[model samples]
Target: MASFFAALMNSLDIALLLFIIAIGLNIVFGVLHVINFAHGAIYMLGAYAGYSCMAMLGLPFWLALIVAPVPVVLLAIVIERLVLSRIYDRDVADSLLLTFALMLILNESIRMVWGTGIYVIDPPAMLQGTVTLFGNVTYPKYSMFVIVMGMLVLAGLWWMFNRTRVGHIIRAAAIDREMSQLVCINTRFVITAVFAFGAWLAAVGGVVAAPMRAIDPGMGDKIIIESFIIVVIGGLGNFTGTLLGAIILGLIHGFGSRYFPEVNLLLPFIGMALVLLFKPYGLMGSGGR
Candidate 1:
């Protein structure tokens, strides 16, 4: 029972982290109808930016956590304007190819700039220790922080989409771009904003993950596949579906790594395949954008 509980906690943590990382990809797809292949690159850049803030700029971890995503958010905005915008009217394949190219460019660019070596970041001082649960069971404080932050992010995103005017505009634009344009909704602006916001969320995940994982140029490539699975298994462009998909994948990872070590890496993909075979759209997904 205790072991099950531990696995549950670990799975939940992984689920939350995956949610934070993949939510942006869904959002961009939801609004822009463009699946961003470079989302992971932006996430990788965020971790590197956090490292830079702490290592080179002499910023504190907390400050770095807050500020590290800014540049990446801006980069997303620029990418949307300079690259994605031009292809908005083209076929979906166009955006995918462009984003794939962008991802490749970012991977090499980051390697050229930050070197091909892997880097790690230390967790904030306040999150350095462990918290005991009951009868010798303890949990890492940083892991707890990740879970809490993920909940907060979930709540914040809910409020942003449900309660805010911008959220309403986003939904409207997403539901009907041509009609939204006719109704005077700046769909162009909304698409750019959503893309940038999604980038911001991805970077935030990267910053949070810096302390937990080794930061490297290859990090994005590894995560992109997982993110794709999460998005697909949850239903492309479906917010709630993404959450459920992340949790399912997280559970698969946690238990599979422990009990089926050799197959751990393949579990999520297997789950993805099952979802595709059974539901095609995902457990919570209705369809693509």
Candidate 2:
């Protein structure tokens, strides 16, 4: 029972980190109707930024957290204006191909700057230990921090989307760009903002994940695939669906890694295949966007 509880905690930690990243992908898709293939690269950028701040510049983790996502967010804005905007009305495949190119470019840029080395970030002093639970189970303090942060982010998103004017404007833009423009809403700005916001979320996930995983140029590649699985399992552009899918995947990662180590790498793919076969639109998805 203690081992089960420990596994559950581990799963929750992994699930929440995924939720933080995949939600951004969903938001961009929901509002802009574009599947950002470069999101993982942007996320990798964030982790590298954090590493630069803490390891290179000797900045504290909290300060690095604030500073790390700035460049990625700015780059996202540029990508939206200079590249994505031109292709917004184009077919979905166009966006995918273009963003895939962007991802390759970003990956190469990272290699050029940071070299092809794997790096690790040490957690801040406060989060550099372990905590005991259930009288016997132990978990990393940083993992707990990640879980709490994820919940807080989820609450904040709910409030923003449900109660704020900006949120309403974003939703309105997503629903009908023409009608929103008719109402004098600067939908262009909203679209840019949505894309940047999604980038921000992905970058933040990168920073948060730095301490938990090895930082490398290829990290983004792995995450992009997992994020796609998450959104697909939960249903693209569905907030509730994204959360549920993250939790489900987390569970698979936690238990599968422990009891079925040999096939662990294939578990998520299998789950995704099952969902795709039975529910083409995703577990919580409807027929169309």
Best by lDDT: 2
The C-alpha local distance difference test score for the whole of candidate 1 amounts to 0.90
Report the lDDT tens digits of candidate 1 across residue range 76-183.
898899989898778999989999999999999999999989898889899999997666667889999999999999999899999999889999998899999998
TM-score of 1: 0.97
Residue-wise C-alpha lDDT for candidate 2, range 155-243, written one tens digit per residue:
99999999999989988998899999999999999999999999999999999999999998899999999999999999999989999
Error of 2 at 202 (Å): 0.6
Regions of candidate 1 where Cα sits further than 4 Å from its true position = none
Name the lDDT of candidate 2.
0.95
Extract clashing residue pairs from model 1. none
How large is the C-alpha RMSD of every model relative to the true structure? 1.1, 0.7
TM-score of each: 0.97, 0.99
Clashing pairs in 2: none
Estimate every model's Cα lDDT from 0 to 1.
Answer: 0.90, 0.95
